[model samples]
Target: MKKTLLILIFLSCIVMANNLPELGDYSSSKISENEEIFIGRQILFQVNQSDSIIRDIEISDYLDLLGKRLINASTDPAKKIEFFIVNDSSINAFAMLGGVIGVHSGLFLASNTESELASVISHEIAHINQKHISRFLAQQERASYQSTFLMAVALLLARSNPQLASTTMAGASAGSVQGALDFTRENEKEADRVGIQTLNNAGFDVRGARDFFTTLKKANQFSGGAAPAFLQTHPITSNRISDIEDRLKDYPYKQRLGNQTFHYVKGKLKALLGDKSNTKNILEENIKNKIYINEAGERFALAYIYLMDNEFTKSQEQIQWLFDNEQSNPMLSQLYINYLIKTNKVTEAKKLYIQNLNFFPI
Candidate 1:
């Protein structure tokens, strides 16, 4: 009986050992808090500096809520995730290893609904939750074991070969930088699986993940060779979409998000990018489609477009609506001042400018 018990115990130990997460896998292990904080700050700096067209508080706040909901479902629910929208007009979103995820403002513009944004956010969140970034960093550290020695040798070589030191530093820095880390094809596949799982658990439409990738594939084809920055880093391939779709097949039921706000935001973004002369054509289509909630954003967009077209009278009519509203944007105030000055409304413009200056400085 004692011998039989020992055999069972040994088998149990073997099973437990097999279950342990291997090195560089996205399991429950954690890096130091200081390291997380350090990386977080760097990501914030990068996000702020990166060029983006939509830097509005309203858009960002909406994203924060969605992000928080998704992150709450993750194993490491405590990790604070920051989301930023890049100004560039590209359908790309990426996560910087240290809990920073950036979605291009163009993504919002392109996305037909909020689920599309959720798809991008969920994928990025998976990258962070799985410690994919840190795992890549650890690998790079191992591969560049001779980096210190190479740096010293390069400095010596720089005397004879001026390019040596610069090249070495560039290579070493690229390896270390969180944003520059490129996942292996295997890691990417794992991220896709986990990302879909996250989207499903968050009650978001997992099919949006598939659809978004399809859109990306189309965009990439159009780009020929010059893919957007997001695509440049987080590559989109045919297999990626197929693989995500396969995983989503297990969850057959589609998730529905009935919020009208997404249409409003997208319509606003369209107006911001579309032509002022054709505003009536575009807005009429939206109205015909019964997109009344988006009317405010479209109006605001037309107003900005008018300012750009130098249509002062039409612009004033648009601004009048903005002024009558309780919510005011300081930047809009500055723009109004410009419109006032341009149209030679000197006295009224001066008063508006002074009020804005006292309340909100440029």
Candidate 2:
């Protein structure tokens, strides 16, 4: 009876393999697409730790606007690029299965210009355009099938009282997990190639990809433990930077500067990063240099810094300026409330807090 049951199970496995869907065709189906998006959204939500939701929206809209322009310019117009700006300050961006692309807020600030931002977006889009996700999925399916076979055999053994099934299943699962991660390195390389082309095709500065990676390398060294989540998945390397430079030589594109959005976002991001002394130093320099794009951001930084430094009087003044002059930004408003409380103006702080909650109801 055991032999007969084993034979039946083997046959069933063979039948499943024969019916296994082609990755390309399977991914085309709506159900497959939805599953990918769902997974991407869940992963994004689970990892978010930022206190500012408004900042996320600001960057998300900016990236989407830029991404749309680039995606529209692609040779294959049917490819869609969906953008999300995550709250994490990590210098990372990720493209999940399907067209879902996410950028960490830190990535926005880390970039020096629009081209740098485009470099990251282009890389992610390249992943989708190259069908990297589908390829990875196909590889995963094979490993999963192998794992299932091993688990089935182990279950059969356990039924006979050996009780090794759980251990066997766990080992097989670990192998499958490692296989998925191993395949990601290949996917990243493919995306890097595609990203450069996307940048060139979209009329962005061709050197931007190399430059962004270079900056990220420095940032990784500095941040160490606080490194962005993106680096954890896509390891940076000197070879990769060299490869990007080599690829750019083949595409002799004209140098065109990026847009206003890049400057705006970059400035805002810097204000979020530093403490009072650091912010004041940067802000003073920016003001002296007449860098208006970052002016509002400098103000926001100064306001937050004063609040943190326990100068309630100065904090109140700065917060008031932000409240009066800046647009309805949630983070700036939250900063104001925080500043008010630090100053011992609890009554005023309470009112502002209530107002903030009303304006940005959770």
Residue clash pairs of candidate 2: 90-228
RMSD of 1: 15.3
In the range 1-362, model 1's lDDT, one tens digit per residue, is 02222223223333433453343532343444555555455435533543432576656766787899888866667888888765546566666545777666668876655677787788778888887765654444332223222221222222112222234335442223323334556767877788777777888887887777666667768879565544555655668767777787898876485444454456445655545558756664664586754455566666666777787787788668667852566545755787888888889889988897788654
Backbone clash total for model 1 is 2
What 10-residue stretch in candidate 1 is worst by lDDT?
A: 152-161
Query: Candidate 1: lDDT over CA atoms?
Result: 0.59
For model 2, residues 268-346, the per-residue Cα lDDT tens digits are 5565554547766767677668775455666666655566567677667766775676566666666666666666669
The CA lDDT at 105 in model 1 is 66
Candidate 1 lands at a TM-score of 0.61
The numbered model that scores best in TM-score is 1
Off by over 4 Å in 1: 1-31, 49-54, 142-172, 175-181, 236-238, 271-362
- Which candidate has the highest lDDT of all? 1
- Residue 28 miss distance in model 2 (angstroms): 16
Where does the lowest 10-residue lDDT sum fall in candidate 2?
Answer: 156-165
